[model samples]
Target: MKILKSTLIATTLLMGISCKTSNNHKAQETGLRDAYKNSFHVGTALNRDDILQTDSLRSALIGKEFSSITAENIMKSMFMHPEKDVYQFDMSDKYVEFGEKNNMFIHGHTLIWHSQLAPWMRSISDSTEMAQAMESHIKTIVEKYKGRINSWDVVNEALNEDGTLRNSAFYKTIGSEYLAMAFKWAAETDPNTDLYYNDYNLTNKAKRAGAVKLVKDIQSKGIKIDGVGMQGHWHIDSPSIEEIEESILDYANLGVKVAITELDVSVLPNPWNLVGAEISQNFENNKKLNPYPEALPDSMQVKLAKRYSDIFKVFLKHQDKISRVTFWGTSDKESWLNDFPVRGRTNYPLLFDRELKPKAAYDSILALKK
Candidate 1:
């Protein structure tokens, strides 16, 4: 495939050329976006917006590339089951329907997690009841969207920072067996959809080894595991490039597809200043960048874009092992970083600035060539 150039003039020229062309459209043209177009499945998790009414965002993605739509909070156990015994499917089903309508693949955010589980799920004392509930929930959700959802996060953050099974509710009730059971039940429910294990900090040596062992262990038990999702939540300075590339290879060596899920580079208060007064507050336009500031420092923002582009460069080099790459949020305004660590602090950590305009990172992503 010929790589698309990132220049505005080149993009306009390509768009015009692609508009008049038909038979020659490549995978990068028809199904995915060219490197210059942010085409590697650019997407955002949705909750409140009506799929039919999201013309603004829909129009924006027309020529951009994206892999799938991930129902971030929608698919999480807590969001699906805010109350005990009363599961909601309206929102999630809408999300999948939207993806299908837009010719976008759908990825289930998660089936199991230590966080965001139903309240009653936490109170279950009997192993049988816990296992039954888990199986039922997984079966119901997976079956409901079987053909529609192309991929699923079978388990989320299952391992501790040290790479051991987290003593979460599921582990406490059914032991480590729950991981295998969750994948088995999900696969049984939807034999075609890809199943994945997703987590953060997989770039660390111990964490990477733990993920490798987890995949091998699950495969050893004859479970239907298909992928490993690395939550690429990097900061401007952390998660060295060497660690990121090595982790991708480790997961692939175990015979599972790898994905950079929940990718975003946090440009908040620097980590070194974590103990001091919050540094994020100093960036006055942080909270959603309301009333876009004119004459902002171009160099700092350019550096930020380079950071994102560098990561994409790494991703492109390992595209053989990677199956998908999903951005965490649609815009910097909607990023989770704003509230994380310190609530109400503004942070810029995504491809688009507050005005839905592409940042320098956009230039870098477009700079990628096949």
Candidate 2:
């Protein structure tokens, strides 16, 4: 990694256009958490394996660079509450403990979602039973982490691209109104904690309109809602800077905070021209799409760095409306990109590489001061 020379880049940003030298050298010493501490929290999603401290280097990096923690999968429905009468807390307990020990802003990944539905939950044949099950699940989990977790994604990926409800089991049985009920139930359980409706393709006009409607409908009914998480599952050269910034302002207008949740910039080529990050999609891998299977070329690394820098510049511009920007995973190797739309394709989509070393993108992001 090269020190961003004090003259060319640093001076230009830190000192201004007067060609003066900056005395704010402390920015060089602090990690990203401090760099953007005043603007918004810098966070990353973690798994039990990372929290257990299996890799001392990665664990240390998490503690140093980030000020917020979110469970990548443990807090999901399947892993947290897998049975009708059973609830698993071993991993979640550890995750909370880790957050407390590190003084991190702990965030629950999700509470209600059409995906990752518990097997027993799927067997419900009546709307009444399904509603009861949803209420019970939210109450139990929210009560357990009442004061532990800071905020929650009350629902995840619940809207379609056309601004209508995705016909998942919950939407089909209980209808779009079920989304409101879900937030109400969560608020009843833990009114103090923040609640958000998180989804992908949030920058798209139709999808964002649907989200804004959900928030307005809930608030109009006197239900508690805190934020709308715009999952930044993006690729290079797409989702232009103007588009993302526009989405931020739009979500901010809904009288709720906006979060860039599940953020990662995939460098690999796409198998097909897809838009949002849906886990169900997959295609056979081709070498053209999986070009850099071993290492990212220098030119691509620079591109990745600039991409992140440009995004953060937008985040800084909308600090009042934004609460947090969380990377989808800790490192490139752990990123779900490898097997999502294809199988066994390496990707460089995170600040840290496979070995957990900070990449050029990290430095570029740090160079961006608030």
Candidate 3:
């Protein structure tokens, strides 16, 4: 009887220890911000619903997993300054307040871009008028959020795939010099904030060359050009790991920091192999295209896990040049790729699944330092 009682006590002690261990592990799984704490700033772009605090689970997940926030669309020209005579700062105030309350690094997505421009801004004809308008736009926004927003994508997607200006209204009326002008006005308004010239497909030589030239031109004029945001709208394997690393180093060589901005690895097949994140692109929603409309295959989940691991390995290698690695959205459900290029296609591109649960991709990223 005594022997049996001793054995039972030992078993109970072991069970208690195991339960404690499991509880501790569950508490530790706060995701990216905790996993990559020392490596770089982990962030997500906030959708309107997220900023408005409408989704409690998402807001909590964002606070737990991310150390930074980007205004996905609220700060853009179309949303914030839709009408020529009107500028909306109400929704934006909530965004800033959320970031402040959480102590997350707040960032402004863009000051100027051709796509998503208000119709009024696009219709300007005179060079002088356009320049004056840009000056007001940059200065007003920067001054409003000067001390709060640590960085600004001062000029976004300004380079063509072939390393030429996009012939945007800013470029058309003000010439390519408008690129420098935008950055200059932004810097003068808030020199303390990190000024970034953001664009996509930095792995492409022509676009890379164009960005290097643009930054160098600004620097030559003794203006501030702090970093380059290499928008990480990558696929499962299209952009070779070598190309990504090369671009990171190339941008670092230009005497500027680098950021892997707007990151999301799409598992879906690209409609036309779209190279950049142009908001105007779309396609008819065919059943064939939205193959994973309801649920993703188990095999593809493994592929996504491996892809995230590989990309993060490169990011860890070039941590010196990179400032932040921001996911475009917090969960797979919120990924804009779902409706971009084609609407109604389910895209499992983010770290968390639709239920706001972490996936194997999350585990893979966490295992990088191991």
Clashes of 3: 0
Q: Compare candidates 1 and 2 on lDDT and give the better one.
A: 2
Residues 1-370 of candidate 3: C-alpha lDDT, one tens digit per residue: 9999966765564444335333546534556787777888999999999999998887998998999999999898988888776899998999999999998989898899998897889999899999988888889989999899899999999888998889888888988888888889999999999999889888898899988888888899888889999999989876889999999999999989999999998888888788668777889999777889888776677678778889999999988778999999998988999998899899999988898877767767776755
Every candidate's lDDT: 0.72, 0.86, 0.86
Model 1: per-residue Cα lDDT over 1-370, one tens digit each: 2444445544564454334332234332432354523434555555454343465664345325454678768778777876657789878877777777777868898888877777878788799999998888899888888788899999998887678888889898899889899999998899899999999888877777788888888999998899999987778777878878888888988888998888888766553343211223333335443322342244445556668767887888887778888878766777777765556666677766677555556545654554
Task: Provide the global lDDT of candidate 3 against the true structure.
Answer: 0.86
With a 3 Å backbone cut-off (N, CA, C), the pairs that clash in candidate 2 are: none
Clashing pairs in model 3, backbone N/Cα/C closer than 3 A: none
Q: What is the TM-score of each candidate against the true structure?
A: 0.82, 0.92, 0.91
Superposition TM-score, candidate 3 onto the true structure: 0.91
Q: Show where candidate 3 strays beyond 4 Å.
A: 1-30
Candidate 1 lDDT: 0.72
